[model samples]
Target: MTRKILLLSVSAGAGHVRAAEAIRASAALSGEALEVRHLDVMDYVPAGFRKLYADTYLKLVAKLPALWGYLYQSSHEAKPDSTTEKIRRSVERLSTRPLRKEIAAFAPDAIVCTHFLPAEMLDRMLRQGDLACPVWVQVTDFDLHRMWVHEHMRGYFAANEEVAFRMRAAGIPATNIHVTGIPIMPVFGEMLERQICAAEYGLDPARTTVLLMGGGAGMGSLDTVAQSLLQIGGDFQLIVLAGRNVAALEALQTLAAQHPGRLVALGFTDKVERLMSCADLVITKPGGLSTSECLAKGLPMILNAPIPGQEERNADYLLEQGVALKACDAVTLEYRVRLLLENPAKLADMRNKARALGRPDAGKQVLKTVLGQ
Candidate 1:
């Protein structure tokens, strides 16, 4: 019998949607009898509410990150009492009407939720006896947030053992959690030679290359980082991936024009893996998907200005792993980059640690665990 797998993801961040897409691709390559489908949870919601859900989140993170951080912590610390349960039920029913309809039509044998919103809704449905399929929640962060927890989930996938330990501490049973590093496209795991990638990308193979990515929305201070890099004296070139942010892209392009051969500014490109292959170091915000891709490539990282809540936690985990440095300001970022350039040994050490921590085959691992194969 062919197994039907529904991957539910939300677009609050690009990571969740990308993780679902990665898992779908992996399932296709697995040679198992499976039918997999990936759905953006927002697609099912009414347009007005959908726009509000996504746009509000982006505005909050971009404009008022501190408030977002405060809400993130407060929600987690709140006790799950009877009133909490009542409020949860009300919110679940209101928000999950579209999802409820989706489940009926899809009739999946197993449901994998890559985002917390769908997981919370699906978990509530299961508890209320509205849905019966086994639920697997993939926590796509290095650190576990309380929002991602649900006692009814059949399994929980975590990025590392430390996160798994935190899951257990959150009152989830040990047997229900699996330490499968966040799923990334298998392309990142490919061992492509840097020289060849540089040649393909028209970069000088002799010069050290730095990649600065601001996630899909281009939400970070890439211009500030670029300015800092220009002040450093080294045999290094800069590549800025200003994803989906035209303003940032234009600003970077203007900067690139000043330093002809030393800088490259890209708008949004599907060639992130190729770019990563050519980069020795990455200066990026601590988003789960981007960091996981960097780790898979064994590239050293300097985390820059992580958002207050989940990103801060992700930055902390990367620091603990010895694979990354946190630089919240342009001055600190410049100093860290220069220090790494002056000391090749430290950069190499970070690369080695990243390789140790990376799970290149995480997609396959997630499939194997969920399917019991």
Candidate 2:
């Protein structure tokens, strides 16, 4: 019999959606008798509510980071039945009526939630006896937020043993937690040829290459960082990926023209694995998905200004693992890059640590666990 699986995510951040996509791709490659459907919970909600659910988060993180950080901390500390949490949960339940309807219509054999919103809703349903199938949750970040904890989940997939430990501390049973690492696209597991990837990107395979990414929306100070990197004295090149940020792409292109063959600017390409193949180091925001991809590629990283909440925690874990360095500004970024450039052994050590921590088959492991295969 073909079992149906529903993969749910909320797109307040790209990492959640991408994690769901990775699991779906894994299901396809598993060759099991399975049917999988991935959905963004926002798509089923009303436009007004959808904007509030997704846009409000983006605005908070991008504009009022301090306030966002405060809220993140406060929410985590707040009791589950606190008035504020109760009101927020009520609003979410009322707004996600359409999503509930969709879930009922699908009637999946099992459900996997990559983001907390759907998982929270599903938890309520299971507790109320409105949902019959088992639901699993995947924590996309290294840190375990309070929002991800629920009493009714069949299992929880964690990015590391530390995250699993956190889950167990949160009162989850030991058997229900699995340290599967974060799910990234299977392509990151492949060992692409560096020379081929470099040729495709018109980069020198012999030169020290640094790849820069600003998350999926390109929400960082890429221009300033690129300029700072250019000032460093080194025999290296830069590949800047301005994801879905056209203005940033154009700005990078203009700057690339100033230093032809030394800098390459691109916008939202799916071939990030190939770029990683040709690079010695990555300068990027420490989003869970991007960091997981870098780890899978065994690429060392200089993490830039991470968003104040989960991203900050992600940076902390990478630094502790000796896989990355965190930079606060353009000056610091330049210094970190220069320090790594001047110390080949240090850079190599970081790369080795990254490879040791990499779970390239995490997606496959997720599938196997969920399917009991």
Once fitted onto the true fold, the runs of candidate 1 whose alpha carbons sit more than 4 angstroms away are 82-85
TM-score of 2: 0.99
**Number of residue pairs clashing in candidate 2, backbone atoms closer than 3 angstroms, sequence gap of 3 or more or interchain:** 0
**Which prediction has the highest lDDT against the true structure?**
2
Which residue pairs show collisions in model 1?
none
Cα lDDT of model 1 by residue, 168-192, tens digit: 9999999999988999987788888
Displacement of residue 36 (Cα, Å) in model 1 is 0.7
Per-residue alpha-carbon lDDT of candidate 2 for residues 86-124, written as tens digits (9 for 90 to 100): 999998999899899999999899999999999999999
Clash count per candidate: 0, 0
Candidate 2, which segments miss by more than 4 Å at Cα? Answer: none
